[model samples]
Target: MFAPQSDRVALRFGDRSLTHASLAACAGSLARELTGLPRVAVWATPSLETCVAVVAALLAGVPAVPLNPKVGERELAHIVADSAPATVLAAPGVDLPAGLDSVPRRDVTLDGDDPGSFADPGDEAPALIVYTSGTTGSPKGVVLPRRALTSTLDAVAEAWQWTADDVLVHALPLFHVHGLILGVLGPLRRGGTLHHLGKFSTAGVVEALEGDGTMMFGVPTMYHRIAEEVGTTPALAAALGKARLLVSGSAALPVRDHERIATATGQRVVERYGMTETLMNTSVRADGDRRPGAVGVPLPGVEVRLVDDAGSVLDGAGPIGEIQVRGPNLFTEYLNRPDATAEAFAGGWFRTGDVGTRDADGYYRIVGRKATDIIKSGGYKIGAGEIENALLEHPGVREVAVTGEPDDDLGERIVAWVVAAGDAPPSSEELADHVARLLTPHKRPRVVRFVEALPRNDMGKVMKRALRT
Candidate 1:
């Protein structure tokens, strides 16, 4: 919930700006029109219209489903049919694909007057229905309640020391939780200002931070690009050093890149852990130690535990196990999938499907996802994240993804898909020896393949599933 602010600027996109009063007036007008709809769809583009549409839906107490603009025809059709939105909202002049033609279209306009006042939607009310990436099958619509959004935002606000005075800057997409909920709604919930770059660029980051921007949120891919150029670009480093906080999420920020950014800019990028189902679970605190590879402790009111395969809760930090979480920040259910909703929970906790270890201090270091990131070779169950981090430390290695392949002898063998740093890349044997020396002999990649680039999704996370295929 946003507190009343005067005519202060609330959102900025490129040269366009929206004051708190103006945004409320525009969204409130649309909210009046969106009222009584079963559900609505927002063409989640990185623009102010998309922001207005989502906020309007929330104001109207109508569940809003965010559709990725880059979604394929098949996935788009599936989402449209599943959510069955009453109308699709988009910016004027934006061309929506044919998949969305089944629903009527409404263009969001900025010139409307506020619709007096509205009643509070109960905490249990569905605020959003966001679809997952569907790594295994068709993407499932995650139903996020009003309480989940409020609770997660409040928890993170406490963790990050975020307040209305903070001017947030980021270029993350608007479809997923990290970008849409955190990047966009997080600021609004705090009654703070947001400066969204229509597209991410080093120059834009420097300009925003050098001016009024106090915090910046980015994924690993964006930070990696910053790390590569920070050494050569003094302005980039200087601008980053001036920021109050720099956060990275959606995937692990390689320790190598973390160190480079820290060394050059004298700032450690904070990492947080969460998914589509759970808005946020853990985050590195602003007032605490800035650990390079740790995602930090669980947020306030959120419970996290490590569980072994036998469904036993593991204690302490030595052993890596599945991360189970119970929190108010969790989504209510998978839309129309009661079977999935029932299976996702273990007893009372939501199974995150992520494997990690928690130290005695309560800090969490994510190993990787259990489905794609855990590698079983010989008698050891290795996490691909650690191996990827090790490989990234090499001077000749630019970007890398580690996966496991079927092997009759070892059950599964570690394989490295690397993007080289230079023309003369390190040989497979040399790289294998490098990893062996850094980690364990068995942890070394038994098979190495050189590639120009690792396949990545919109969030900059390496699509390991694509590599396996």
Candidate 2:
């Protein structure tokens, strides 16, 4: 979409700003260098260099697989063995493993070559392979196509009314779809400038807001921290008001936190829904009322249905069922995992494994996930999110994770791992009593353990399986 006169900035890092023309030239040169390489693996270390490699790969028709650069040796080795890319673009000083061509940023040469008018790829051709957050154990690479990108961008733009003037403050990482595709690609496709940041801090984010940035994209945890940081500063509060829209994703934004952010920032964080398999399915409106806890109607052209265990569609709004989706943005398949891909789909609709209920107003509320996190206690199904939300309300709690622990009597018991805000947290009995006041007695956490920090994977999702182990 780059024209000679196009007023767009492709990247902004520190004092440097790469124009669309420069970015196009660099991508083409990188593409030329990567010619004949079977695959390119980018260990996503937050940078403009990583962005250049990704866009260059797309333009070059080479499959680019991005791995979590922050992961340890164990996780990193698994990704390298799985994808086996011919070339790797990584941060400087990170030793390259055997049998891969690694290029450092300073060594790469870029003499202008046009990133010619991009011709959108077929619906079946693989464009990118994003790994799931290996919260369970090993992560699976979710293969997405070019059509998925275009279709999703169109749908998102239609539903949220994104414009060329909108500048996005990208706090999320480039490795995750929410951060890279939705945060970077969505705005770029509309000819918007992405004010990129390597890491997020209270002052840095506030500084980005002071610029031309009109929109903000972040996970719920970030909003909570930013809200806390902006407690009583009128200047910071007014700076936040400059943002036209704010999006919350990766995890659902709790009602209390959402309200707290809106009160401090003057912009209600619009909650949306998506995963690695499907880039984005639904989003709250840009101009209308954003209902708390409900991911508003599906984006344009995306079909959503609630189905029971029998795969039969539910007719009422009161019951929660598996949220299934079939859309243009849905991935073509899981990379080389035919059986796993086959298992993910049922009657053409991809089973999201998430349980949700639709309201009369057409808003969808996520209740729980099917496999790893959802817990059933006594005769009632419990969503760990409820307890986690309530736990966050306590002033002593810094972070909380709830999971199902096996029990002989209730079939399953609620176990919570908490990171305390202060040096000393409340006693387990006291914390249990606090949760009991907010949740039903049966739903209250029976086991509360104090920890320095909750174990998390590269993507920042809590590793509940590891916690159980």
Candidate 3:
């Protein structure tokens, strides 16, 4: 890909840009310097240097572990000790944290070997050691091979009609699969150009779209902000309306936001489903039905199935079950934890804690997470996602999260935590009635709590455990 697009700009961050030839030369120089290292830790920031470091590690066949720039001290210590990288790769003048300061540092710069190509790592070789979020306790390192990375990027490209002519624009972090692999590596694999906004801002998004941006990718939080502004900000709406393709992932985008953006821009943002373990299982195709909440069918080369608690395959109209997937896009293993690795796979399918239902048309709709989003209330299995979507339609509701709380009468009672949109939010009774009218009375929140904001993970997923606590 680089050999042909030597003079073309491959990446852009703020005012800095890297042509394909320069990217190759710069990364190759770093690669040659990191030749003997078994693995390297990249201080993943949304910058040209971070992009160059990742490309260099891949070229050198040394597995790269991306550390979140905003990582907590405990998580940082665990990652540093577990991966045991020979050195840390960082942008020039960027200060290392206490845990990483002791490690040898290599400053990534454009002044490297002359423009040339290097051998790509084998498809089966380890490419990344991305750590899972420490939701349960400490995060675990997920080992991803070159095969998984390429297969996922290729599938997404085919689905989105992505090519060198398409210029991608985003402002997501570079520490995770959504930001790093799909956002950065995706464009590179297709020989396309990437414009990163450094950090997400409505103004930045509008600027990029107003320019040469053809495709946009964002998490739910970013889309939520877009939804808020698009109604009153015609310029922002126009900018988004001009985008060739809009995608939402990492966390589910509320149906209300989808509708709002669609109504304003005449574009339905495509949604995809994936995790740290499975790079990507399904996505609403660029040409497929752009239903508000559908994650669409499984990507090409990926197999998805729904099974009950007893492990029986689900069939027929609407049976909500846990998602089990099998594909080359799956990660190789959790680094240094064979027991955990074995537990993740059953037969050959990887168990995704997510639960969802599949329609006859093959569009899969996410219900909620098995661990937290599934509400066992009054002998009914209600998914928090649908209720959250329904509640989002309420005019007074700005952000909402649904959960199940303990109750004496019912096994669990549904709870709705909301952030009001205006000075006066809708009454709990009125909001509950609204949801009942939209969904069902049984699904309405038995208790509604107003809050300043919903606690969320970096990807914008509502942290249900925090609400429970």
Best prediction by lDDT: 1
Best by TM-score: 1
TM-score, every prediction: 0.81, 0.77, 0.80
lDDT of 1 by residue, 96-163 (tens): 98888889999999997894587888999999999874334456899999999999999999999999
Candidate 1 global CA lDDT score: 0.88
> How much is 279 displaced in model 3, in angstroms?
0.7
Candidate 3, 168-209: lDDT as tens digits: 999878988888999999988888899999888899999999
Ranking by lDDT: 1, 3, 2
Residues 1-469, candidate 2: write the lDDT tens digits: 2224254786776665676767788777787776566777886766777777787777776778876554434445656677777767765566554434333232233455666654544566677888763223345678888888878988888778887777888667787687778776776678777887667776777788888878888776666666666667766677778888888776566677677767876677788888789888888889767878888889888999999998899986778899999988899877667888899999899998888999987888887776775565542345677678778889889999988876544546789899998887888887777776654465678899888888999999888888999
Worst 10 residues of 2 by lDDT: 99-108
Can you tell me which runs of candidate 2 are displaced by over 4 Å? 1-7, 91-112, 117-121, 134-137, 373-469
Better of 2 and 3 by lDDT: 3
Q: Give me the runs in candidate 1 sitting further than 4 Å from their true place.
A: 373-469
Candidate 3 vs. true structure, TM-score? 0.80
RMSD of every candidate to native, in Å, equals 10.8, 10.3, 10.8
Off by over 4 Å in 3: 1-3, 373-469
Among residues 3 or more apart in sequence or in different chains, the pairs in candidate 2 whose N, CA or C atoms overlap within 3 Å are: none
